[model samples]
Target chain A: MATFSFAVMAVLPLFLMIFIGYFLRVFHVFKESFFNEVTRFCFKVAMPCLIFKNIYSSNLDVGSYVPLVVFGITGIISLAVIGCLFIPLTVKDQKKKGVMVQNLFRANFFFFGIPMITNIFGEEHIGPAVMMVAFVVPIFNILGAVVLAFFQEHEGKKRVDFKDILHNIFTNPIIIGAIIAFLFVLLKIPLFDFVVDVIGDIADVTTTIALISLGGTFKFQSAKHNMPYIIRGVLDKLFLVPAIMLTIAVILGFRGPELAICLALFGAPGAVASFVMAKEAGADGELAGQLIVFTTAFAFVSLVFFIFILRSLGFI
Target chain B: MASSFSFAFGAVLPIFMLVGLGYILRRLGYFPEAFVTLINKFCFEVALPALVFYNIYTSNTTIGQNSGLLIFGALAICGIAAVSLLILPKLVKESPRRAVLAQNMFRSNFILFGIPMAANMYGNDGVGPASILLAISAILYNILGTAIMAYYQEKQRSGKKSVHIVPLLKSIFKNHIIIGAALALVLLSLQIQLPNFLDRTVSDVAKVATPMGLMAVGAHFNFARAKADFRYLMIGLSGKLLIAPAIVMIIAIFCGFRGPLLGALLGMTASPGSITSYVVATSMDADGDLAGELVVFGTALSAFTMFGFIFLLRSLGFL
Candidate 1:
């Protein structure tokens, strides 16, 4: 019962936001030109400040999770290997192959993941979550990029360039912010607490605004075309994968919060990485778009079940 | 502190309002065909880079030891994602478009929405790690991501095989966000202090970034296009909300990840598609509409998925 209410609490606002945005558009409260200016304003000035503020104020730690890092990486490698075995057999077209690689393995570690978890668990759980992100992002970049490149390249055509992958990873804005933030933390440099406080305040406001924008962007029309892919994606990401992961967690003797975090993440929607990979690999960009929509929509069901399952096992 | 419900609702309000306005204007036929292009250019070239530069430059967090481990971990996660990308297409026997849809389903939105949440949750420490991950992804988005787009375009054009390095590098360097971030890093490394006036000026300019961005995002929201692109949108929704997160869990567990790292990693693993994908698609002339659909659908669906993940984690004591 508590879980059900919680689910409603979580879902209601999202729906409202989308509905409101859509309705406003339908009603013509403002001009289209205004949105462009707003997008420009956020993207150029505000977002960068937010990124700078976060990194400049934080302290970095290098050896925080050596064992965890190693284990996490190894696991990804194994999955990739297993996944690769199925790819060639399942997808004969090189173009299609590129798309497949992105779908199954990519993880959504940013937008929804960070905000949702932080809101639920507070700062204490942040350290572990942060550490995990550090480990997971690069593998997605290089390996994901390689797969994308490989599939994107015409059959019997030019060889894939390793340098391109490195370049892509190095130049990214988000990645750059991550690097600077890491450095600040590592050096143990002191920043003005007041500056951080200001940034924090701004961050709070920005987060809400970003969410609103996100809501406004939702479109239901596309769901119709993406049914089959949606079903498959949902099964793989929400059910099959999480079930396997929970079993592993239970077997490993991880109890309490540790177990909970692992299980919840396991059942999360597909990563946004697939979207990026699809675009990069020259797959069906529209199809990739729809897949993200479908899986996320169904995540609530999987999550609720997981919570019940965990509660039943006394993992909480 | 704001509760999750309040926080999310509050965050999303402005964008929706703006989108509503944009929609009305379109219906009224007040704008020319080039309006979208103009809006997109402003958001893409100017606003985005500035936002990125400010974010990277102003960070005061310290870099810790074992940074390499974080990098490695990200790589490993990517490795897993690569495999998923490879395999999912086969399981479903999807077309190239469907295959890409499957992959996008799994990726995260690290930029606009992801990083700020990291800051809010863990303060500097969390943001620092997220930044590293984002950087790695940036690199991938440009060279590797671009290469793939080129490959597909070539295939469609007649199975051509040549990869262009110059254009890829040019795009990366020419990107305002990347340039701004680079500048910030250089300034920070040199420990350059801004003059009081300049600092104030910078802050003032930065202040407008978010609200303006939200407004722009709202204004750009296209319901009609989404309706037209429904098929692609479905694929994106499923892949992002379902398959991606599941894959992350399997990979994280298999790799033996636990604790907060597991949660944070998974949280990120569940993000919707990024706005940048749209930008990249536009720049490459690949499929910006698909990118936009992914961003919109993924963002929307993520709420449910994210909530479920959070609730499950809390129930199991992770939260």
Candidate 2:
């Protein structure tokens, strides 16, 4: 019962902000262009600062990296491979296979999941979560590149350009941000106090702006057709994948903050970047958009429910 | 919280340092005006609102707590407007220019400057007083601005006086600044509690409001405008940036305002002339050239004046 209130207290406010964003849009308090620019700003400026700052401030144990890293690094790849192979059977359309594979495999761990951790469990526990984000981000990117590269192949770019994949992976804002922060941590780079303050301040702005941007970008003028694919996408991304991962983490004896972190990272909605990638790749962009919308819209209730259950069961 | 931490020099330094960074970056051609404009808009529409809302929602401050700041802020604004109205015509003979000068002298960029100053001084909770002052300033600025402009235009036309209350109220109703502050006030007054994550998110964004806003204000500085209509620019700026603030701060001092309350008043009175003066001037067919010059000159000169004023106030232990 105590944990029940804790669950609500931890989760509800972040989700309420999305509705506030929606209402702002509905009342015409904010325009669509603001949403587009804010989304870009979050992606380019705010999220990078946050990712960099989190990793920089974290205290990592070199010995402790054995279990969490091995699981994180290998886990994402296996999931991506399974998604690429399995999703194609159900999701026809060469275009959709790529985005579907992305939708299933790419969790919004950094944007939504990481903030949720700091909000619930505080920043001290973020060392492991940050490691997960650092390793998981690159894996997600490379997998996304490979999957999209395969699908875009059908559009008559016959050569599988290895150069393009490398460029795509290295140049991703999130990956670059993570890499830079990692380098700073490893080298013990000393920064001016005020500069650190500025970085820390901007880093903190990420979650609110991202959530509000999500609400603003949400399209109530959604498509009527292909409701099934959207439903399937939401379930696979929010429910099945998270359930399997949480159970696996539990069986592995992960508890407390680590268990909560797993639930959040695995349970988060599909990555917003997947939609951007899909649009750029010319693959079922509308479907990708809807998948982002529904999964995010539902993740609030689902994530809260999961937290409540886990807390009650004393599993986390 | 304010008792535990003295933000006197610590808070004031960050504002100017970021502003200096912005000015240097702008001068080096690294941050262009268009980029600063976008940043300004982002800060104004999205981030600043969240900043204000976060401060108001998270703090245990009530409307009654800030009634003094609200009353004094409104009174000081009206007093300035009255001075401008009574004195501007004698100083500037042209009808359109009369309205422009009055608006320039009366309006201050409290939103950009006030919130940041208060936030820096007293931290997040201090924003409650600052925001209430902001709402009062916005309301009075619009009312006085429209009436002053309409009064001049009416004189030029030799026609009946008219002030569009409905449209003015509607605009104020939808204003993003008021919306943010108002929503928080309503929620607070209703004894409502938002989710913790929401407040946490708001706090994160609020931390950004000052640095980005101050830097944008710095980048917005145009030294080239120093040569444009040099004499009148000085007149408008001196009155807006110096004389008006002096009058208000003196009155506030006599009223026993000190500490964070004094800090909030300093934000209200001592900041530069508002950027909106130009917009309102042009739209009202007033002397936009003079309005534009006053804003640029006032803001540019204000960086120096504000630093001095803040330094002086800190040394005097008023804030």
> Model 1: what is its DockQ?
0.01
TM-score of chain B of each: 0.73, 0.64
Can you write out model 1's per-residue Cα lDDT over A1-316, one digit (the tens) per residue?
7655544433333334334434544556424444444334333333434555554553334364454455456655655665667766755666656555566566554434444444344434545545455456678777676666666656654456778777876775455656666666767667655445444544444433343344344446656655655566568767877787667767766665455456545555655457756775667666666666666667657766775667666674
Candidate no. 2 TM-score: 0.76
Model 1 residue runs over 4 Å out of place are: A3-64, A91-94, A153-158, A222-226, A255-265, A271-273, B1-319
Q: Across residues B91-179, which tens digit of lDDT does each residue of candidate 1 receive?
A: 54423453345336435566545565555555676566666566555444433444455444444455444546665556556665566
Sort candidate 2 into its docking category.
acceptable
* CAPRI-style docking class of model 1 based on DockQ: incorrect
True contacts kept of each: 0.00, 0.30
Q: Name every residue pair that clashes in candidate 2.
A: none
**Interface RMSD of the predictions, in order shown?**
16.7, 3.6
**TM-score of every prediction relative to native:** 0.46, 0.76
